[model samples]
Target: MPNALSESRACLPPPHPPEVAKGVILDARHALVHAEQGWMAIADVHFGYEARRRRAGALLPDWGMPQCERVLHELVRDHQPKRLILVGDIMDGSGTVEETLELLKRLTESVKIICVLGNHDRAGLKRGMSMIPSHREGEFLFEHGHLPLSDHEGVIVTGHEHPATHFRDGAGLRLKLPTMVQEQISAKTQRWILPAFSPWAAGGEYTSEHKRLQTWACGKGRVWRV
Candidate 1:
């Protein structure tokens, strides 16, 4: 693997944070942040999803890791957060976790990385990285959203659904883009599901009939309210 930086890696640029809550910022690259504490939250990266699919007879291109690396590098460069909390599902298979470990070895030098294990990430936890079951930041409970949520769960922040929407770009080209779904469950509680950061994420357009669901759709370097 080549670790050389591209002189002009113009394709993947860092995104600006679109304020979702009082202190919560969602960047176009699919990162959620609590700015006051310098903590960045991300979920549903599925690092080896493509490779897993390919092995399962899906004709997918092997482009997941490099793309993830580019987005991550750009994200770190732009935000420079003190800590990065991956909510869950960082990889789909063991081979992919090994790849992720190699990437983390370099990333850990600059940013402290933490991975909250997701259903597809058992192998990653066994690798001895900074893996945790759940992380609490301020009043937020950061975890993989597959488990049941209770009233006592506090303000939940997660990613697993890979929510998205279909929309036209500035060039008028229709595209399936990732989305951030926020639902206010109660007077004092809220759950936010972030879009997948992997460029190859097999996301479907999300449509909701619920009255309380608020969505922010993102593409390229911009976010559009939906």
Candidate 2:
């Protein structure tokens, strides 16, 4: 049986750019950013969400497909990123690889797509990960953050927390916000945890007890609540 750590690690494809960071940059109005390094730093895109939910007989809105692709395409055209680093959970459930590949091919014209598999990306359907190398930096761990990370010497960036925040007035009218998480990889390394890029995907609220707190303790975790 595959352990959770292995399963999580399996979601990351190879790094497309030699330089892990630095490249084209696009700040999506939706409270996220993108890099020309072919990485779209959006959170919780949850592609095929409606289909998955519907397959389970759950009647919800069928709004994820067009909206998700539109945002992705807009970001891509605006930033011209050569790759996409999906922080985690690109799909909502056990998404079909055929569908994913088709969607990816549509998005990836000349760019590469690197996904740091999320809790929802079931093992059986993962295929494109093998195209890119996993664990890019030396001891630079990359995972979905569903498990505790061992103390290491390099930077660590992941998803699975699906961090989002909300602010409210005294009357309790709340406003939803997307957040960008940044942390120091070590004394020399820098880490960034991207929000879910998927619009329809649900997330583990940042304040939840199950949220990963260690990444936030180094005084480097900054939340850009957009």
Candidate 3:
């Protein structure tokens, strides 16, 4: 598998020139911290993914929630952001919504949570979760990329694509890691796509033909442009 991936990578053209996010720092924990705003954001948590699969007859272990809790707790503890933004898709709509809310309640104890609902979150909304379709602050707009975004200026910070990248290590081991994508739409417009935070969500790789785009991969306790 590793050898096949390495060969495929070699056949592709080199990535475009790098673009830097001035005030946003990509977290190794599959989140982004906006230093200027004192806020941290992650997209597509998709909590209860394993439970959803198991309910459909897949014999999976019940480790998804614990893993999600650990990452989120550590992120909140480390960054101590005034607000934690869940860009979208907080629940997979198949598992127990009450269980998901329990974890969210714990998170709210430390920081304010701003949840923008995604397609998978319809159940959460019906259950009375106070979520919005979009959030705007300053020049940034936050939403789940599953819907059509209205015409807007400045940056659109969202997650729905669940961007990712694939590579092979020196030992011929193939790996698929979640990625964050930055698309330069115009001089005044940009789109920041975040990876899914759920450990079980194997996100799809980005394959756009944009001339000005940057892809950052998160894995092994490190985040780097790839």
For lDDT, the strongest prediction is: 3
Error of 1 at 209 (Å): 8.3
For candidate 2, give the lDDT of residue 134. Answer: 33
Hey, what RMSD does candidate 2 come out at?
A: 13.2
Q: How accurate is candidate 3 locally (lDDT)?
A: 0.81
Per-residue lDDT, model 2, residue 114, is 67
Q: Report the alpha-carbon TM-score of model 1 versus the true structure.
A: 0.82
- The per-model lDDT (C-alpha) reads 0.77, 0.54, 0.81
lDDT by residue (127-220, candidate 3, tens digit) is 6567888888778899998887646798898898988898877898988999888887666778888888988888887766554478888876
Q: Write the per-residue lDDT of candidate 1 for residues 98-141, one digit (tens) a residue.
A: 77777778778779998888887865455658677788887888
Worst 10 residues of 2 by lDDT: 216-225
Those runs of model 2 whose alpha carbons end farther than 4 Å from true positions after fitting are 1-26, 29-39, 128-142, 150-154, 184-191, 202-204, 207-226
Whose lDDT is higher: candidate 1's or candidate 2's?
Answer: 1
lDDT of prediction 2: 0.54
- TM-score comparison, 1 vs 2, better candidate: 1
Query: Which regions in candidate 1 have their CA more than 4 angstroms from the true location?
Result: 1-16, 54-59, 150-154, 168-174, 205-213
| All candidates: TM-score | 0.82, 0.66, 0.85
